[model samples]
Target: MKNLLKNGLMLLTGILMLATSCNQISDSESGGNGKIVLSLTDAPFPVSLVDKALVTIDKIEIRSTATVSSTTEVTTNSELFTVLYDGDPMEFDLLDLQNGITTELLSMDIAAGSYDLIRMHVTNASVLLKDGSNFDLKVPSGFASGLKIKMTPNLVIESGVESEVILDFDVSKSFVVQGNMKAKNGIKGFIFKPVLRATCQKYSGSVGGKVFENATTPIAEAHVQIIAADTILSSALTDAAGNYHMIGLPTGSYKVVCEKDGYTPVTVDPVVVKAREKTTLDIQMATATVTVNP
Candidate 1:
């Protein structure tokens, strides 16, 4: 009788252990979703000429490939696309977001998986010049279809993790000048062709510092660029405070150059950057000397 009781207890214990293991497996597979924190940033714009650059975004969407149960409806574009945000249109001045600064656009919970692309719908765009003149910028196809940007390295969201994504608007490249800046009526107008890039914060690094002519004199409106293999990776202009910042760089060594109209350009090579790290590099430039003919 004692043997029978002992065997029964053992069987019950084994069953309970098995049930606990099964529950753990279920939780690990589908316990919860991940989160995404989206933000906007801009490369240095020519603040000396352009006073303000504005853009209004109405909707945002993401493309994922993970086979998870979702309530997202199949859009005409693709079934793998999901609407991350669709609400009030938010307008932002690109000039205000620079020098390592950013403005949060949206934040939401997303399924744990891999996302490859992001599309942003732009409703309005305009530019104001320092001369008190403004013009409504035209957005070709972006008004209807949205501006599509592919992720450089595919974004991976793990269960219960919060990921940060930054959308960088390149102002200098997007706005093409129609006329010469020095000639009267030289500045006819500008054509708007939106150029944007996306980066994941966890896998990228940043570099920033002050550009100066001397220890106390800051050089404003100076161009700072990062170069690799004779190509420019990214660039920024010094603010009034002589500060410039370049973000979303992959982990590697880069050559940095700082130049202005009147000052001699300075170059620093092999500046190493690591993931999630910020490298500080302050540069001092001297005035360019002109050669006089005898």
Candidate 2:
């Protein structure tokens, strides 16, 4: 009876030990792995504007590989992961450039790894520019030449984790310039057909009884007009402190006129504006009464 009891106890202890060892191994296998991520960002250059243009861009390719010289050993395929652009799935080509070369974006759940050599091939691009007349040919001086960015590269991706990469290229500077009127011509010619541009800035100053009499305090919401020749430009209303801005006008001499409900109309001297520049004009309306004789 004593021998049987001892045998039964030994059997129970062996089963418990085996179950514990199996659980430990399973946990180690499940939790010991890591991951990699890869991505591409922004375009390389600006878009070109020429006499006439039209274009479109299609696809881009990239290759990633591990390095033996380095300590980390990254040997895993991540072809199952996704590649996207502007939040869209972008098509790509995965190729082994050489024998024994694992050339592809890789993501693996392993202890940890290192990598090298991320090659890129940008392809499937298209561009289009409509008729030359579509562009505002009178572009400002010092405007930057346009270049199109085609493709960018994806360096590395650590899986079970997040990472970032950039892809971009530049298209040559070429855009249409269409317009009968050109700035290089003489001032009279350009001025006659000048590109209209105007800008305004606000100023605040208190108007005392000298400008408007009989009023306990200054009035608000005055009307301001900028007149050039027969053409009248911007008009604005004053705020609590009497400030306003009018923008986008052609270069010329302008008369500033200010009027309020209880104040006399005020007109300032002609303000001259240069091309592609802003001119400032402020006015204070005086108070006066008009009497009609029958």
User: Model 2 over residues 1-294: C-alpha lDDT tens digits?
Assistant: 000000000000000000000001122223333343222111111112212222211322222322233443322223411222122333321110100111123332333222222222222222223232332223222211111111111122333432222111101211212233224531121111111110111111111112222244444556555666644443444544555443323345677666776678888767665543555554556667878899
Which residue ranges in model 2 land beyond 4 Å of their true spot? 1-219, 275-277, 290-294
Per-residue lDDT value at 27 in model 2: 24
Candidate with maximal TM-score:
1
Give TM per candidate. Answer: 0.83, 0.27
The alpha-carbon deviation from the true structure for residue 147 of candidate 1, after best TM-score superposition, in angstroms, is: 0.9
Q: What shift in Å separates residue 194 of candidate 2 from its native position after superposition?
A: 24
In candidate 1, stretches whose alpha carbon ends up further than 4 angstroms from where it belongs are 1-31, 67-78
Model 2 has an lDDT value of 0.28
**Every candidate's CA RMSD:** 16.7, 29.2
lDDT of every predicted structure (CA atoms) = 0.69, 0.28
Residue-level lDDT of model 1, residues 1-294, one tens digit each, is 000000000000000000000001122454368787776777676676778888887778888745324664423365567887779987888888777667777677888777666667778788899998898977775336667666645677667877777666766666666788777785677777776766666667889999998888999888998876776666788888899888767778999988898889899998997788999999999999998999
In model 1, state the lDDT of residue 172.
66
